[model samples]
Target: MGLNGQIPRCEHIDRCPVVEHGPPECRACLALGQSWTWLLVCLSCGWVACSDDSRGGHAKAHYQETDHPVVAALEPSSTWRWCYVHRRNV
Candidate 1:
């Protein structure tokens, strides 16, 4: 997560899965019991995955494979998101 503020609309905003499905969809947590340190929601397809700080860093892998740049934090009350393409929080 980065500074709190309004996130400018980006190209992936329409397809971001976080807007459609919440973080409970994390497959890594369901399948591997991976802890959700900084839970991530795929912006490309909405597939939730654990953060790099978690057991598998599946979130990063998801981006590597899918090239989906934006991911919303799954923690309660957190509205922070990251952009892999920009290498910073958007």
Candidate 2:
């Protein structure tokens, strides 16, 4: 629930830019020679980053830097979307 006791909807999804795909791996992790556990694709801008559970938490970092709230799991078998601001699956 949100402050108004209503479920918060993801505001970024509708305005997300359409991207065919993102990079194969986290660019930040690659530049730093670090390993990432999983990848997430930012729906707002299609930035590929590491999950928060990863060493660098690059996905969360990207959100902090860009205010892009929604991200979809970039795993082959996953079809889930998450809302960073609402802290829930969208």
Candidate 3:
């Protein structure tokens, strides 16, 4: 299924203000000089941030901060996405 249909009403979608600029800057990853590995879809407010700072820990932080779970690799080649809370692929 396409993302539109696969991902139901992600609450974060409206709350996410980062999408306005194409892709939000990977704040967590930029600090570490490591390119972002995944696009963390905020469950609380769909803010797409880079995974972890040094490879995608920020994504986990979002999970830690908010119970919302679900993240996808920003890589175009990747179609696999995961939900941390659900502990399953979406």
Candidate 4:
């Protein structure tokens, strides 16, 4: 199945960058070699980032800066997705 088939249609999809790029780069956090503890999928732009960066505090930063609220796992092995506002896996 494709990512669309695996993930649900989030209202924020239209604003997410991951919708176009597939995933987002975490240059600030990835440089640290920190194992991502969670995936912060941007509710505004669907940017996927490692939670190790404060559970995607950067992603949260996107929300705080933009007022969006949604995210998903960027884990390569897992097939789970979630919504920040709902606080439940989708």
Overall lDDT per candidate, in order of appearance:
0.73, 0.87, 0.60, 0.57
TM-score of 2: 0.81
Candidate 4: segments with Cα more than 4 A from true spot? 1-18, 22-24, 30-35, 52-56
What TM-score against the true fold does each predicted structure earn? 0.67, 0.81, 0.51, 0.47
Please write out the lDDT profile of model 2 over residues 1-90, one tens digit for every residue. Answer: 588797766776767787755767999999999999989998877889999999999999999999988889997789799888879887
lDDT of 1: 0.73
| lDDT tens digits, residue span 1-90, model 3 | 448667454443334344322256667567778686456555445556776544567777777787666666665577666667556665
**Candidate 4: lDDT over CA atoms?**
0.57
The best candidate in terms of lDDT? 2
Task: Give candidate 2 misplaced runs (Cα > 4 Å).
Answer: 1-9
Query: Among these predicted structures, which one has the highest TM-score?
Result: 2
- From the highest TM-score down, the ranking of the candidates is 2, 1, 3, 4
Q: Can you write out model 4's per-residue Cα lDDT over 16-73, one digit (the tens) per residue?
A: 5545324556654677765555555554455656663464456655655667666666
Residue 53 Cα positional deviation in candidate 1, in Å, after optimal superposition: 1.0
By summed lDDT, the worst window of 10 consecutive residues in model 3 runs over: 13-22
Q: How far off is residue 21 in model 3, in Å?
A: 8.9
Q: Which ten residues in a row have the lowest lDDT in candidate 2?
A: 6-15
